[model samples]
Target: MAKNMYSLMLMDEVVSQIDRIAAQSSTNRSNLINEILADYVSFVTPQKHIQNIFESISAIIDDVAALTVQDMAASSVICIKSALSYKYRPTIRYSVELFSDNKSLGELRVTFRTQSAELLMEITHFLSLWMQLEQHYISKFDSKDSISYAIEQGRFKRTLMYPKNSSLHNSDEVSKAIADYIQMFDEILKGYLNGEYNTDADVEYRYLNYLKSGLTVI
Candidate 1:
């Protein structure tokens, strides 16, 4: 039996960066990275097969050209593009609401086609960086686009990052919003599998562990 599928090491620079990001974002760094990992799932789709599947779902959205497979060469493009945009950290969860399907509140597990281990690490790295930035801005820092300083007075009003807006807001509101996005993502996944699948619909899948750990955005 293999033990510990992944290894962990502490680098000083990473820790320092994490601290700075944590201070700026008002997140504790660990949570920030977790959020990023959750969002990366949206980008996990392969380039080649996306169109074949999307072509199959053409009837649901009533797009006549969707059946043609000509436009599908637009690799990595999804019909619900915005749902996977992930502009902000929390927005990943918010994306679940865009779907029309209704799945029972159980669990679903789906797999992406695999090509060994090359791309997964790259995805993880990019997502980790973005997550740190999102956490800092969304939770801790207030941004300013324009500069305001007194040059003539021989004094500089340093740009300040305000620390406000603690995470004391209502919990239920957040939960419902997250649930909506999850539902929408589920709907999209259900649609994709139905289109692409020839195997049994009830097949047990290992991807369910992801939902249990945390959801990711593409």
Candidate 2:
């Protein structure tokens, strides 16, 4: 959304009340006021879209065992936290930032963290292969360079475009995409780290099995 500077006059009591609410919410006064005005105007802001996406994701993955999804913040830049399947159960953070002009599309970031050097190296290898697989798979949809991944120290970050297709016109479609991505990623990573597979072919086979089994969350 485009922002503009505007001068307004308000009563002292109203300003003080807004300040109190802002302090309690741990948000700056300007942001608090913006949200209040956006609500009053019935604008479907990016923050609202993000919240809907998070709710949908929660519903889709709620049944997965040993998994937890949390909304780190209910704002335009929504950070979602999920527990990955690992020795120490390292957590993955999905920071979703939506563009106000297009509520159906956004940037989805998958971030992983672990302390062990060995595990980190293995994860990096897995991420590289995963990137190749996704690139090849999405190419069938005529997508070009829509997914990217990077690794630094103990963190692995994979960024992908949400609603890869603009036709994914609703919150449900976007939510399903998010859930499906997380499930596929978790399954393949755990399978690889658990010594269940050694090659890309094996991973493909497992993923196909997952599709046939109609399991989108694990």
Judging by TM-score against the true structure, name the best candidate. 2
Score candidate 1 by TM-score against the native: 0.20
User: Which residue pairs show collisions in model 2?
Assistant: none
Q: What is the lDDT of residue 152 in candidate 1?
A: 17
**Backbone clash tally (model 1):** 13
lDDT of 1 by residue, 15-69 (tens): 7888788667555666445445545754321211222333333333344221121
- The digit string of per-residue lDDT tens for model 2 on 108-214 reads 66677667778778877877777676666554443333445565665555554533345654667767876776767676777888788877789878766765665
lDDT of each: 0.31, 0.67
Superposing every Cα of model 2 onto the true structure, what RMSD results? 3.8
Per-residue error (Å), model 1, residue 44? 39
Off by over 4 Å in 1: 1-115, 141-172, 180-218
| Candidate whose lDDT is highest | 2
Candidate 2, residue 29: the lDDT equals 76
| Model 2 regions more than 4 Å off | 71-74, 77-91, 101-104, 142-145, 162-165, 208-218
